[model samples]
Target: MPERKILAIIQARMGSTRLPGKILADIGGKPMLCRVVERARRAACLDGVLVATTTRAEDDAVEWLCRERGYVCTRGHPTDVLDRYYQAARQAAADVVVRLTADCPMIDPAVIDQVVGAFLAADPPVDFAANRLPDDRTFPIGLDTEVCTFAALARAWSEAGEPYQREHVMPYLYEAPGRFRIFLVRSARDHSHLRWTVDTAEDLELARRIYAHFGGRDDFTWGEVLALVEREPSLAAINAHVQQRTLGDQA
Candidate 1:
């Protein structure tokens, strides 16, 4: 068999209801989306990185930024993100797909490679793999990484009819249990108590501080952030009040 092409697709749009245009929000004088793409590109296991944005006029900026930054971009459904991912993976000829969100500027490349490694190393070969799977999360929220075979993504695109499944992507595979062979890559320690995803003003503030601590660099690892927060315990409190919305909570 030919070598599997592992592609990382970062889904982004300017239509966030909680924090509109948050993907473009400044983190150390650079866009959060830029930080996310930069870090993802550093993953050793990924074949390439692509920004998957919608065709909405608001998202045009995202596409333009991708162009200016020399990043590959693909556009698809505005709300149906599963379709967006499926189309992006198809266009890239990806045998394996790594799903990421634009909100995660502090996503660690090491964690991403770990999850991808787990997926590739599974005995029977898992159809889906992720660092956090539903309620069993161990890594910080921003470090969320999901890897799935192109076949599984195509399956979700075709059969997942629920609105949440379409918008969030990958739920149909994990939520259904026996439908797909799944793997969850857990961190050595539980850091789910910390929040690093940018969803609200508080989240943005926390991320800004973290980036600033690194002197406006995007190469900092998640371990360094953990150490920073450990030395300055108040850093985690910046967005401690922000609650993550689950699929059931989403409209």
Candidate 2:
């Protein structure tokens, strides 16, 4: 059999309700979406990275940025993200798929490779793999990574009917444990306390501080950010009070 193509698809949009256009928001003089794309491309395990956005007129800016930056992009359903991921994977001819979000400007490429490695190493060959499974999350919120086979993605796309499952894109696979084998790769230490995602103004402030510390570079490792937070405990306090929306919460 030919080598499996591992594709990383970063889903982005300008219609965030918590922080409108958060994906286009600036961090270290670069858009958040660009930062995510740049970092994800550095993963040694990924064959390619694509920015998947919606066909909505508001997302035109996302497509424009991808074009200007010479990154591959695919357009799909604005709300039904399962369909979007399935279509993106199919179009890219991906045998293995990595799912990422533009809000995670601090996503670590090494962690991405780690998750992919775990997925590939599963004895029974899990249908889905992620650094932080829904219930047992250990990695920081922004460093979230999910890997799955194209067949699993297609299965979720066709079988999932709930709005949340369709919108969140992989809940179905893990939700029904008996149907799909799932694997969760956890960090040595629990860092779920850290919130680096750009979901609100305070979250953005924390991310900006991190980017500023790295001199606006996207190559910094997630460990470096952890150390920075360790030195300055106040940084994590910025969004400590911010409540993350539950899985059932609608867009």
Candidate 3:
């Protein structure tokens, strides 16, 4: 058998319905997308990192940023994120793919490594892996991780044709539990309540508050975010109801 190559592909775009150009928005000193890519690099299991972005003209700036930073970039259809991922993975020649979203600047590298490790540590075989697909887990939103074989991805690409499936991608694999072996990462509910994802002005304010609490530090972990949220409960109250409450439903 051939050795599996793990690739982390971050999906980003210049247009965000809730927070326009949020990826390029400044968090601390650097753009939020750059922060996310840098954090994804810290995952010990990821063999490579690529930013999968949209082909829209607005995304040209994202491409420029990638080139300037010496990071690999791939562009594909904006709406069909599943297709974008498939194209990016094909270009990167990845055997195993990890999905990350650019809106998550405060993502924890430790959590990324743990989820990746769990997939690799699975008994016989792990066809797919994610930290918070079912949503019962208390992990922070920005701290999501997914590991899937190229074969499985190809299967999803060919078989998962629903609009929601194409938009979010990989939902079918998780719904059909018996089809793929999935590894879930469940740690204490430390940062689970922390609003790290940026979707609206409130979410942006929440992220800014987190950076302020941590003094604009990029090395901060979800544990640190949790500690701060515990100390200042008001900060955690920011946009607490933003993430869909239905996300709590798990299989």
Q: What is the alpha-carbon lDDT of model 3 when measured against the actual structure?
A: 0.81
Per-model TM values vs. the true structure: 0.98, 0.98, 0.92
For all predictions, the C-alpha RMSD in Å is 1.1, 0.9, 3.0
Per-residue alpha-carbon lDDT of candidate 1 for residues 1-251, written as tens digits (9 for 90 to 100): 57999999999999988899999998999999999999999999999999999999999999999999999999999989999999989988999999999999999999999999999999998999999977899999999999999999998999999998999999998998699999988888999999999999999999999999999998989999999998998999889988997885632
Per-residue lDDT of candidate 2, residues 77-145 (tens digit): 999999999999998899999999999999999999999999998997889999886679889899999
Which segments of candidate 3 are over 4 A away from where they belong? 245-251
Instruction: Report the poorest 10 consecutive residues by lDDT, candidate 3.
Output: 242-251
Q: Pick the candidate with the highest lDDT.
A: 1
Backbone-clash count (model 1): 0
Give the per-residue lDDT digits (tens) of candidate 3, residues 1-251.
67789998999898876678999988777888888999888878889999988999999999999999999999999888899999889888899888888988887788878888888788887888888865555787677777788888888988986777777767867877587777777766544666678877777787877877667778888778877878888876888878543321210
When 1 and 3 are scored with TM-score, the better candidate is: 1
lDDT of 1: 0.93
Which stretches of candidate 1 lie above 4 Å from their native place?
Answer: 248-251
Candidate 3: deviation at residue 217, Å? 2.4
Off by over 4 Å in 2: none
